[model samples]
Structure formats: structure tokens, C-alpha cells
Target chain A: MEKQDQILMKKQNKTYVLELIKNMAPISRMQISKNTKMSPTSITRIVGELQEQGFVKETKLVTSGVGRKATLLDVCGDVLFTIGVELDKAVLKIGIVNYVGGMIDLQTYVRNPLESYEETVQNINDKVKNIIEQNAIPVGKIIGLAVGLPGSIDYENGIVRVAEQLRWKDVHLVRDLSKLTSLNVVIDNELKMKIIAENTVGKAKDSKSSILVGIGSGIGSAILLNGEVHRGESNNAGEIGHTVIDPNGNVCSCGKFGCLCTYISEGAILADAKKMKDISSIDEVFVAFRDGESWALNILDRTATYIALAISNLACLYEPECIILSGNLIDKMPEMKQQIEEKCERYMWEPIKKNLHIVHSSLGSQGVVLGAAIQAQNSLFDIN
Target chain B: MEKQDQILMKKQNKTYVLELIKNMAPISRMQISKNTKMSPTSITRIVGELQEQGFVKETKLVTSGVGRKATLLDVCGDVLFTIGVELDKAVLKIGIVNYVGGMIDLQTYVRNPLESYEETVQNINDKVKNIIEQNAIPVGKIIGLAVGLPGSIDYENGIVRVAEQLRWKDVHLVRDLSKLTSLNVVIDNELKMKIIAENTVGKAKDSKSSILVGIGSGIGSAILLNGEVHRGESNNAGEIGHTVIDPNGNVCSCGKFGCLCTYISEGAILADAKKMKDISSIDEVFVAFRDGESWALNILDRTATYIALAISNLACLYEPECIILSGNLIDKMPEMKQQIEEKCERYMWEPIKKNLHIVHSSLGSQGVVLGAAIQAQNSLFDIN
Candidate 1:
């Protein structure tokens, strides 16, 4: 009844219409109206406003039954931009991503193994600013920047609760970044960010629910629920590596005994290799295993089985349509794919096994930065 | 532009408004408007129409601002009813539930352990019709019925994929029941239904996301995502029991090795007891443990450890705020609750350990029927 409420209602309707178009890219107004159950007039009005605001644009034409063409509207993918940074133990990656998850500018740099959280933030801030200037990116065009760290992060508050890989604890990452730069900042766990990226533009594009399992120095998994990564009560969900596999077998870095990571992480695999051979890295171990060395084969086979078991467990719990494997181990050891899938099939509940699809992460190393970028865009645009 | 489209939009908005009031319960129109961002006039019109349709009513008056009363709308809880039935091997339960998940009538009956699916369906149909008629429940006032079965069900098609406990496989339960009755039917796993009920009106009420782990003849768990049971790609999402704990352990009922259930299910405990002494049921095992028998205590302690590990793994994956234990084993042996919680706390990642809470299912035996009723109501109403 009130004037202010009517305006709010209009704004809400506009946001809904814009979101609908964004998700259903290259959509016709008729399709939008049908899906939203909105009147054609309302759809037209909202779309017109969106176009005028430079948020949407006419892109293509779809052939209709009558040999006529229906004009399609798409969210202007490059109209807004976001910066994504992935802070790993030995490497740092940055990308400027567009509204549609397109990377505009990207780079990776070697990370100082012993850099303090504050020093790392400062270096990252300088690089991001330099990149923006180099590319002549307009300050107003870029939304907030997002950082993905390898740790249990308080994503909502941008605090890293514990990053065992980075040896960082309770670091107020976003606040630190925000103080050093004008850009607003968002932060989340690296695996969580990777899953979001995969859901947006990779193997999980058609999946409303999926899981991404990362098996690098530390193992972790993240769930994508209806297109958003699930951040549970404390953003520590998907810490699967710490889940016990053999409660009495061996102690994990977290001081827990027989964690899943102890048997399957890249570090774990390397440690296994070092016990009998002069192998220094996972690549050497994988090479030895692929060439049919008995010791290496045994270790790889067991880890592959564990990975499959973990996938089966995740499938049963998350009921995900797709389980994607990422991180260094998966990227390097393509031979283990068949082994893991076979093992997962052997372990999975028969019904879930029938529905589950296991795959390699399509985004791979690019997922973290793109995911962080999209998350930043979401934060600035209130996209959800 | 068209009358049909206008009418469709009006109905959609009406459904939205009614669902808002139903979920918010005892909320004023002003609060609804504020939350939904609808114009007050639109809210009043929708509320008035819903009130006239007997879907909602003014049920409360809250004193506000100096001696004024603000009237609140509530869903007409009894205006619609649903029949909920839980089917297990030895016992069956039926409940007549109202719109707001309140139970009007509840009864339990003995079931033939070796009955055929068709025979079981026939008996249930006959009893359901008789109960409805005996209670003078009008056919029009009641929504379709829902059945909770102990199986991996193809919920969308109402087919039981596998139910090791019930010895069921690929039974067209819904079609068989629907063929015999005028009402449509919906079916899901018993654990999934229980979690829904608990999330709505039991121990999980305070939690937006929670897990209900039921330790009965078969160990099973279900997740509630924002008050709705998460049915994964094939409605077999929370098959945590079948998730492997040991690749070389013992074979489980589901033909898997070292399933979490092999360590914790009532059948497993009974089998363990049998391995030591002549014991027929889990009740005997619990009695032995309570009486300080080391054999029984050892079986229980191992199962409790596995149960705690399973809970810790689930918490890591699902990030559930609360984990609720259910079924007869937990219902009868309340002392195991503390031991399991302690074990889970010991194994959990520290951050999650601080955030997670373990509790017993408050609804206990009543969860299944009530949950099925609410699910049936959801199907008929499109409440989500």
C-alpha cells in the first residue's frame, strides 16, 4: 500500500528477472516469461531496465518454428570484472574474471615458502594493482577481489581459521587486503572455491549438486549444492583428509591418527615412496608406478583404492551426480583415473554407483582463481 | 497480456504468500511484507484471499507499542490432512497428520515378517481406508499418502531399488498402492523421512542443516538441508552405512566389505554377540554391556568408536550443525550416546569439534510416520 514498498517490490522483481536471464543465458524474453511465470509486459519492462543499466544485452537469435528468429538477451559478461587470487603453499595465481566466468587477464607467480601472511597479502595487493594498471582496467568496472587459501577459512568473515598447508592460523585475510587496497575482499577455502568454479564453467556445468576432491599436499573435498559451494556452520566442511581411515594406522599432520590424507595425499604418497626408494617428489613416484615397479605399484594401487573408497563415501553422503578430482596428484597421475573409478565402483552402494559419475576436474589448476573471482562478483552484486 | 497468464501469475503469487505464512507461523502481514518485499496492499490482498480459502487464519494477537495488538496469521493446521505410514519387517505405523505437521491420530500394528510386497500393500491399503472412514475423515480434505520404506528407493518413480533389510528389490510400490486406492502415493527411505520430521518438529528444529543417523536393524543416515531432507541424485544420498570403513574388514549385508554399518548396525551387534555367546537381539547385547559384561562392552565400544568416526566424517563432509541419533538401538541404550559423542569429539577437526553438537532424536519412534505425513503434505501442496 505504501509508496516505498512498491518501489522495493519493483526492485526485487528486477533482480529476479536479471538473475533469471543471467542463469539462462542467451534466453528469449518469451522463455524468461514462461519460466518466471511473469506477465510478458513485466518481463519486457524489467529487461528493458536491465539493458539500459548495461547489465544485459541482445546477443543472438534463435530459429523458431515459423522460420522467424527470436532475439536473445544475455548478461553482459565483460561489463563487470572481479579479481581472483589463489594462495597455495608454493605457488600463487591471479586472474581477472568477467561476469560469465571468463578469464580476461591471468598470471601465476612462485610463492615464498616462508612468507608471513601480512607480507604475502602486501605482495599480492601490489601485483593485483600492477595487473589492473597494465591492462588499463577501469576501477569502477571491477568488483571486489577474492582470495582462495588452502585452509579452513571462516568464509563469511574472511578469516582463515587454520590452513595446515600454509601453516597459517586465524589470519584476517580479507581485512588485511581491504586495508592495503581500495577493493573490497572476500575469502574462502581453496577447495571450496575450486568446486564453485567447476560448477560454474567446467565439468559440473549441468550439475546442480556435485563434489570436487583435491589431492595435493593436503586432501580436501568441497560440495556444490544447487550451484553454490556448501559452507557449513564454520566453513570447515569438506575437510575429508582429516576423517579417519584406520584410527590406529598412522598419525596425520593434524595430530590425528590414520586420517584419510595419511594414506592418499601427495605428501603421503611421497613419504611412502621415500621409505624404500630415493624418490624426491610425487612425479618420480608416479613414473615408477606407471613403469610397473612393484613397490611403487603397490603404494599407488593402495592410494588409488583409498581415493576410490573416499569417492564412494562422498557419493553415498553427498549423493552428487559427479565427483571431480583435482589438485597435483590427479593432474600428474592420469593413469590412476581408471583405478580409482574401478575401486569406487567396487565400494559404492549399488544404487548410488549406478547414478554416480566420476571424472577429472575440467578446470584443474584454473579453478581456484576463477571461483574466487565469481565469488567476488557475487559479493559485490549481491548476485544470490 | 493474456487473461490465462494473469491468472497463472496470481495463483503462483498466492502460493508463495501462503507458503510464507505457513513457514513463518503466527506472523503479522507487516512482517511478511518486510520479509518478502511485497507491497503491503499486495500482502493484505493475498492474506485476505488465503484467509477466505480456509488456508490461513488470524490465530494470535501480539501486544506491541503501548497497548496495541498486532494480529498474526497462521496456517490452518487442520484444514488439510495426510496419511503417513512406516513399513518395516516386524512393525508398521500409521499417522494422520495435519497441515502444520501435528499428529491427529497415531497407531502401530504388527507386520508379517515374511509377507510378499503385494500382500503387504493390500493389508496396508485396507487398513488406511478403514482408518480414514472410521475417523470420518473426508476424502477431499486429505492429501495423498506417503510411505516410508527401509530401502534405497527411486523416490521419483516410487520404486524400491534395494532394501537388504526388507529383502526388497525393484518393487513398484507406489503404482501397486495407487492402483488399489484413489489417493496418489509417495515413498522414500525411512531414514530420509525421519530426518525430515526431526528437522521440522523434533530435535533438529533449531538447526538449519543437520544429520540424523539411525542405528536400527540397519545403520542409516539422512541429511536435512534447510529443513528439507536431501535426496541425492537417486534418493540414496545418505547411505552412510554402506560407506566403506575397511576394505578388508567383514562383508556386510549389502555385499560390501567393512561398511560403517558392519561395525554399528543392530544386526552387526547381534552377530558379534552370537560370535561370543548365544544372543538373539541387540537388546541382549545392550543388557550385557549395562551389566558390565566385558564381551558385550567390547562389541559396543568398537561399534561406538566406528559410529563416532562415521559421525566425524559426516560432519566434515556435510558441515551439519547438529547430528541426531535415532532408531531402537540408540533409543534403548542412552548411555552409548555420551561415549559416541566423546569419540566423535576426539576424532573431529578442532574447528568442527567446537562447532558441532550431538544429540538424541527427540521424536524417536514417532519420527517415521510424522515425516511421511509431512512429505505427503509437501507433495500435494508444493510447499517448497
Candidate 2:
């Protein structure tokens, strides 16, 4: 146990130094020692290990205040890679992401909505192999693999408890993937991964805490507090879609009435739009609204109001620095930003709203993949 | 910066040793070192500091595996004291709590609702001074003071941003209290302090994470995630009262429509009861219900449903191990628990609800004061 504690401390110090160099490139080892308050000996030892691992690199020297030349350090972003996979009902996105969360290669594949979890896992294994062989990447450079999907995921056990869209229940994602692949395996909720991407490399890069609200097939949110995912007990903290909005409103797929998702989700909007005209997709509804159809306008206007209410509720609950709008609805219909912000002005509580920013997701289609890869790297990276 | 970091590390190590001794007393220093994986020298140094501070004392000796008698160590609960203040619009509760959260002394005074912040602070100063004089405690033994009240608080700055019940806005609680009291001061939301007490010594003592729901004059919740308050951007994360539950419902005091508090809070229930008959307090409505008044039963039953709904919403959002119901309503009306539980069974989402326990607070009225005092101890206690 004592040895484990020492190892943890060593790893923490090493990660801290690597992150510092990654964030503040061309910084000297003395600067890192000063910033972290680690001894110069400790800094040298950790930096030596990082360099051996091909993570840290010495750049050109800069003259110090006393005219002494000091060598600056930076991280080699391409020295490590992690595989990120986004599993959805109709599509699967796979990518190889570098140490710095940059996507080196990405591929999208159409998935049969009725495919079994086993078949999906097999497909993921095959695709990962293809990506590796095609890129001719050394096996030692790849850290691990992570899959992001929608559902109440038991991240600890890597089980998809229930993903309604994927029609999966109690799927042993990590166990199956581990059996098929040599790399480490991890799985998390899609929104959680999206928030990670936003926090690390996207819109919420400067935020200490943020919430990502996904509003596509279903609505869900993920919270990042002080750089850690606020996974509630059972890793199901941000299932805001199931939160009752109105006791007497429409029944949700979760058997609850007036859940937030039932009113503002893509499926719900399409369903509401079909009541007025023969529309099967959210895009068609927007097209009809663009043509000034009163029913379409009514559906969208009501959707914006409920979206604002959802934001207001989240603000009341989490009070995060920012709430990034994401998923197909926000990503595709960028014009809705103005309406949502306008309604937020009326719906949001005054106190918490003062410092809150309602922003769009900077990562478009790459959020889940990039975030999942970063998560894999985070979980598997070790200083030995 | 380097020296500061070393000091922080040393303090952390000392705190860890002290906490271990407090939790697992009657164990030798060898066992503590084994458990913490700290060196014998480091453990001895920390223990010696704690001993000099009067926090730790040697207990009876026990034979070790090597046949040598080892002296066991334990924490002294009465070595230090902190003042806990629960300030409400109509009442002011002050108490001197010991290190282990035992109430050494307590006092309650009637506070006029129209009193200014300065007047309240002065009253608190006088009351605290009186308690200290009455107890005849040494000045060096006292740690500091902490105040817990309702509504939004900027805890970092010790400012009461807006507490509707107290009609306070932008009131510098810590500054005013500091001007009168010689001790250091801290302040937080009432529910936040209540949950701290619960997490430390009450119903949630064994819980890794818990939520406290205060359902009295208004409804609010405090979340403890891994033993830390999940204070959001403004230390106002759990303001469930302002969360809009119904888009077309009654207006809340915050000018919001259909907030959860507008349905289940004590004031809301009393106002609702008055629709059927003249009612002055919540007790009258319960009396009418006991007498089989249909209107009274209807009102109470609906209140139970919304209370359940509020729990469901919280459960969906937090997925905490347990949600402790407290404040005047839950404490005074134990009979309503069964109804609330039944409604919870019907309202709560299945996946997240399975492991969640809905329990009543055990600390009674001493909760806020004990919590505040402990918080003060946490913030002010130092190992020099």
C-alpha cells in the first residue's frame, strides 16, 4: 500500500509536469520546479522518465534573468495515441487521437440499427485492426481504446445498463472489447465524452467547470467540476431527460410524464411536427418553419422555450461557469442559438445567470471520438 | 511558492495522520504508518505535532506481533471548540461545538424579521461572547465561527448574495461578524452546513456521498460528493426552489412560475390550505387532515406527490447514495414519511432509484450549528 502511494505521487508529479509543459511550452525545468514546488532533483528525475517515455522534449535554450542559458521543455504530442470510438444506433465513428487530443485519423461507418451488441463489438475490433494496419502504427504507441455511447453506463464495470437508442441492455462492453483487443478498454456515456472534449480542447477549455447539454434523439447533460467528471452514484448523474418538467404533460419513453426530453428532444419535436404536417425529420420541420408555416413556427418556438427552461433548470442545479449546447439539434440548427439565448434571458434565475455563458459546442462531429481517445490516454497513461 | 507548497504538503500529511487516528483509534503509530503508507519518521513527526496541539493522546498499550507493547493513540475531542451559528429570519441559534461535533454549549434567541444585517451581526457577537463567558473556556481553545443561513451565498467572499427569507442582498456576513468578533469567520448556505453535519456525524455519516433536502419555508438541497460540498460557480448549486417545474403554474417569490417550492414548501402548503379554510400554520392543516377534512387531505396528498416529484428530480440529477429529508416539515411531521415514500416509489425513475435511500435527518435542530462549528474547525484548525 505504501509503495502504491509513492507510485501515485510520482505519477501525479510526472503528469503535472507533462501537462504544464504541454500547456506552457518552452518552459524551463527550473520554472516547472518553481511552479510545482517540487525539488529540482525530483523535477529532473521525473523529466528524465518523461523523456525516456518519448513524451517530453528539450527545445532551444533561452537566457535567464541572470544571463544564464536554460533549456526549455515541451511535450511530444505524437509520441502516444489512443483509439476513440463513438457507438450510436445508426453510425459508428472511430478515430486515432494523439497525446494532445488531436485527431490523426478518423472514419465513419453506417451501422444497422438492429445489430446485436456482439456484432457491434466484432465490427469495432475489425475496424480498429484496419486503422492500425493502414496507419502502420507501432503497437507500443497506442495507449488503449474507449467507446462512448448514450445510456446509463456503469463505467466502472464497462456495462451499458440501458441505451434506449441502441436497444442494448446489460451489454458487457469492456469485457467483450478487452477479450477482442490487446489494449485497455473503457466506456462512458456519449455526453460525458463530449463534455470531456469540450473541457479539454473545445469551447469550455478555459472553464473550471462546465455542463454539456446534448439535444438530439434524446436529451442528456454531463458536468465537469474542477477538471473531474461529476459522475453521480452509478455514473448516472446527468440523466436530466428523465427529470419531470410538468406532471400533466406528455408521457416520456422512460414511463415518466413530462420529462424534459419528451418536449425538447429531436424525436419529440419531429413527433410534434408530424401532428401539423407530414414531416419525419428535424431538418424538414426547420425547412417548414423557414417557409413561415405557423405550425412549424409554433413547434420550434415551443421547443426553444422548453430548451430555455431546461437551461434554466440546469443553471439552478449545477450553476456551472458555462453550459455548452451540443448534439445534432444545436450542431445542425445553429440559427436556434439566438432564440434559445433570448428565451434564456426570460427563464434563467438572476443570481446564477450573472456569470454563466450559454455557448455553442466548438467541436462539431469529432467531440465524442476526441474525448473518448483522451479519456483512454488519461486512464492508461502511467509513469514507470 | 516552493516553501508554500512544502507547507501545504506537510499540513496535508499531518491532517491525514490525525484523521486516521481519529477514525481508527486505539491503534499504534506502527498501524497508522502501515495504513497511510507513510514512513515511521513522518508519522512520528505528525503525531508529535498533534500531541503538542492537544488533539491526540496515548491510550493503553497493546502487545504487538513481535511481542513488544505498543502504545495506542486516540484523538481528544474536547481540546478545541468552534462557534456554530444558524441565523434565520425569526430565530438565531448559537452553539460551541467540540472537535468531534459534540455540542459543548448552546443558546437560541428570537430575532426580529425587520432587523438590519448590522443589528443581527451585533446580536450574534453579544450572544457568542455571552456563551464563551458562561462556559469560561480559555480563549486559545476556541477555533473560530461559522454561520449558516438560507438562500444564495458567495461563500468564498462571505457575502449573502440574496437570501429571500431574510430579505438580504449583498450583505457581507463575514466582514460584519469579523468587525465585532475576535475569531476568524466563515459562512455558507444552511443546507450546505446541514449536509456537512450529516456527512460527519448524522444519518449520512457512513455515506460516501449524500444529499440533504431542506423542505421548510422554502426548498433547497446540498450535495456532498466524495465528502466535499458540490458548490457550483456561485456557491448556489442546489437552489431547487427556483427550478421551474411547470411552465404555466403559480408564480414563486423569485418571480418564477411553477417552482417546486411553490408546491411543497411549508409556506406554500399553508397558503394552499387557506384556500379551503383559514389556516395560520402547517400544524392546522395537519390537524384538519387528522380530523378527516377532505380539502385538508387533498392538499396534503398533493403536497406529498410534489415532494415525491422533487425527490425524483433530485434523484435523477444527483443519483446520490441517499437523500436526507430535513427542516421543519420533515422533522415535525414524521407521519408524512410513509406517504412521501409511497409517492417516491411511484415517481422516481427506476434505474437511479434502485439504490437511493430516502431517509429523515437525525440531528434535529442541532444540525446547522454543529455543522457550522465543524466547518469553522475545518477551516481554522492548524497544526503548527
Q: Residues A230-251, candidate 2: write the lDDT tens digits.
A: 8888899988999988988998
RMSD of 1: 5.3
Best by DockQ: 2
Looking at model 1, residue A16 earns an lDDT score of: 90
Instruction: Give lDDT tens digits, candidate 2, residues B1-384.
Output: 699999999998888888888888888988999999999998988899899988999987674676777898989988989999999878899999987778999899989999987788899999999999999878788989999999899899989999998999999989889878988999999999999999889988878778898887788999888878888888889888888889889897767788887897878888888888876878898788889899988888888778888889888887899999998887777778999999898888888988899999989988999999988988888776
Worst 10 residues of 1 chain B by lDDT: B60-69
- Give the per-residue lDDT digits (tens) of candidate 1, residues B1-384: 899999887888888888888788889888899988889999999888887878989975663676557788888887889999999888889889988788888888988889887789898998898889877888988878999988789899889888777778899999999889878899999988888788678888767898999888778898988767788888888888888877778887667778887888777788779989887777788889989999988888998888888888888888888999888888898898889887876777788888788888889688999999988987776531
- Give the Å error, residue A215, model 1: 1.4
After superposition, which runs of candidate 2 have C-alpha atoms over 4 Å from their true positions? A1-80, A125-143, A178-184, A381-384, B1-79, B129-141, B181-183
Report DockQ per prediction, comma-separated. Answer: 0.57, 0.61
TM-score of 1: 0.84
What is the alpha-carbon lDDT of model 1 when measured against the actual structure? Answer: 0.84
Q: What is the TM-score of chain A alone in each candidate?
A: 0.91, 0.92
